[model samples]
Target: MAEKQVQSRYAPDLMAGQVALVTGSGSGMGRATALEMASCGARLALFARRKEPLQETAEMIRAMGGEAFVVPGDTRDEKSVEAAMLKIKAHYGRLDVLVNNAGGQYIAAARDITNKGFEAVIRNNLIGSWQMTRAAADHFMFENGGSIVFVTAISTRTALTGFAHTVAARAGVTGLMKTLAAEWGEYGIRLNCVAPGTIKTEALGRYPIPPEKWHELNRSVLGRMGVAEDVAGTIVFLASRLGSFITGEDVYVDGGETLHMGHDARDMIHPDMFQGRQRGDGKNE
Candidate 1:
């Protein structure tokens, strides 16, 4: 007789009837994470500037027999964020999970970064996430506990000259996570982060790296780039019962990119002819 292989039935269904707020949840990693949480039965609260995409996410959750509420708001605006939080609280009464995943950056070298671009990135990515966390923390404190997951980038620690503003902002988020973890532990709140590596989502188009450089970006401890699921799953875990003991830590889902430290700076000086690699599989971008 053939025997079935035994596997651990470890399902962290910690979010049933729990309210989860996801920002920039219309597409890419944010959307994926929201959908995953819904699959596990958490009622979702989605925030994004675009209505159509946020609605799309809500539709997916509804299709799965899960509940979701949509709130369109600009992450960079404090009033907008507060209003969004108020709307969620009004709809659900309590929030169990908060994922600050909305972020952006101008992909230029430090020398070419403009003041406007720097300020914009800092305001939207760092300050916006801070406001969202603080607003939710006030409610969680009274409730005695909650979870927050910040979507940072592996590039923050393994510095790249092209993303100066994003790096600084995300580094600040790391520090914020640690501070809050200590401050809010008595409330049973766990604060953490997830840093993703080269992912092939819609945002990947924004990075104007040539084929050789793009390929080099994947030459990490692991040889291939990760998809949205790789990073999304980590966020779900961090916010679930499985990660109850984990906090004040940032998990990197970069397929070993940080372990590799990226390619040498001297590689940038190589002639195009010498590099002999083209973007778009030899098609000019």
Candidate 2:
């Protein structure tokens, strides 16, 4: 049997006449967020390093009777970001929302993390997001007043053994958003961060953990892995009028996983730590 296509609960015109830019929108959470925003009547500008995926996302949106423009560029490049913003301004004439969702990282112990790897992750996650935010503010949002959402990780709320680089970079993003929320408030620009727990996306396959282990490690209060749409709804809310007075807040969409901070150092460092343990008996096999 086919799974049912769940429709959005938000009003169809919730974001009418708004222009939203979503980075890393070629797949996973970024693509999900873009679709949701379009369903709410917002014109979308999809950004990603690859043009093919961006084109695909745009096609999907257009098929649903929504408008989308594809902008392919690396977020880490200042010139690329500036050019993208310029194109958006020229095409849309105004920007209403900016979703900084493009970032990536690999799992490695702090000792194993090299300087090159650390710098790459920071540049991609922190510096790239900051550049996009600044360009948007300078180009349109500063005077026009808009919303910005940064997609961070649940690791920012707790320590995970193999994700030293990601935790550091995302933590920086959280701090940046908080400070900007205060500084940009007078300009009518809103800034916030959305931290997702262990979401089941294509990107998850990059990790070496098995499916069952992933479930056990990420067993949140909800007792299930999150889907991309789970994070998308929260983002759409922040970018819409519903979240007008809300800013500088780091919203955790992690189904209470961050409450206990999820995994411990052992679970992350040793993937097979519980392999021989019996669940109810608490005995090693």
What are the per-residue Cα lDDT tens digits for candidate 2 across 20-126?
99999999999999999998999999999999988888888887789999989989999999999999989999999999999999999899999999999999999
Off by over 4 Å in 2: 1-6, 262-285
RMSD values, in order shown: 9.1, 5.8
Model 1 residue 11 distance off true place after TM-score fit, in angstroms: 3.4
Q: Which pairs of residues collide in candidate 1? A: none
Clashes of each: 0, 0
- Tens-digit lDDT string for candidate 1 (1-285): 122121212243656778899999998999888888887778999999899989888887777677989999988888898898788878988898999999888678898989988988999889999998988887554475888999999877877778899999999999999999998888899999999888868887767766556766574556777877777788988998879999999898988777666555335654573355645345644
TM-score winner: 2
Give the Cα-based TM-score of candidate 1 against the true structure. Answer: 0.85
Candidate 1 residue runs with Cα over 4 Å from true position: 1-14, 210-213, 262-285
lDDT of 1: 0.83
